[model samples]
Target: MESLIAAVREQDEAARFLVWPGDFDLDRGDHVEEVHLASGATLEGFAGDGAGGTYFFCGEGGEERPILYADSEGGAAPVAIGLPELLRLLLVVPWWRDCQAFTAEESRELAAEYLEDMPDLPARRDRAAAALGIDLPAQADVLARLREVAVRMGEDFVLVLTPEGHPYEPLFTN
Candidate 1:
């Protein structure tokens, strides 16, 4: 994880793409509000997005732990089983946040918008992936796995507010 982060930080274009399209900023690991897991597992905030959304590594361990994404609006979801999987999602389908329906057509439509804005998205993503030593999956496959992680495996890892003791709503739905 440290090496991958260093590689990303070393590259200007890869860092820019991750910050813009991927919505991932390693420097912003702190969460705005107090949060925890309903299961009482350790939730470590390791990254954040532009909209105050945090990516937490669930449970104790290393970067191999499951990752849960919690939005400022009190919504959360298990986005990936590990850091590598999460990076693949970000590098392959940076438009995952815009994919509400989680379908191929929706991905294509959203991908078009990104491609129009950055024609070298694929090439840039490839370079980023290569730097991280990760082989990304297809867009549809990544999205599908994302949904599966968020909706299925996500059931066991729920996010909750610490002070209010209120649980966050699920970000993904069947």
Candidate 2:
């Protein structure tokens, strides 16, 4: 956990976006006790929240840790495993969300434009890919793969949280 936190802190892009609760002195035992009391589950680690949801690590020690997503409404669901895998999933979420509203070509163009706007995107991409044990491809290839993952994971998997509501209700319910 310390290594993961250190890595996230070293990356400028990650440090700007990933909000680890411990970084804010909110990962104390009292906080975990409160969570356990409120919900029957224990909090292994507080990863971060974005797009109107919080990501957390939950599992007993000596077991495989699963990453869980808690929506703004207090609903929770498992999303991925470990911090590195969760970070990888997060990197492609925007691309997945954009694909829903745009055509393939438009999505690709938009992804490229978005990456172009982020000066440190390449480094971030490299970090995420290395963590996930996957290769980061060109913009077009990335868009294609994002679409493929969305299709494979289903519509509910690529939920987009809007200001008015949480789109992850269906995911949580199931």
Question: How many pairs in model 1 have backbone atoms within 3 A of each other, for residues 3 or more apart or on separate chains, i.e. clashes?
Answer: 0
- All candidates: TM-score: 0.94, 0.48
Ten-residue region with minimum lDDT total, candidate 1: 1-10
> Where does model 1 exceed 4 Å of error?
1-3
Q: Write the per-residue lDDT of candidate 1 for residues 1-174, one digit (tens) a residue.
A: 375667778887777778878999998899999988989999999889999999999998888899999988999999999888998899888888778888989999998998999998888888877767788788889989998898898779988888999989999877
**Which digits, one per residue and each the tens of the lDDT, describe model 2 over residues 39-141?**
3345554543443445555646422455555445544445555555455444544443334432557656755876677756656666644653444344455
Best-fitting candidate, scored by TM-score: 1
TM-score of 1: 0.94
Q: How many residue pairs clash per model? A: 0, 0
Backbone clash pairs for candidate 2 read: none
By lDDT, the best candidate is 1
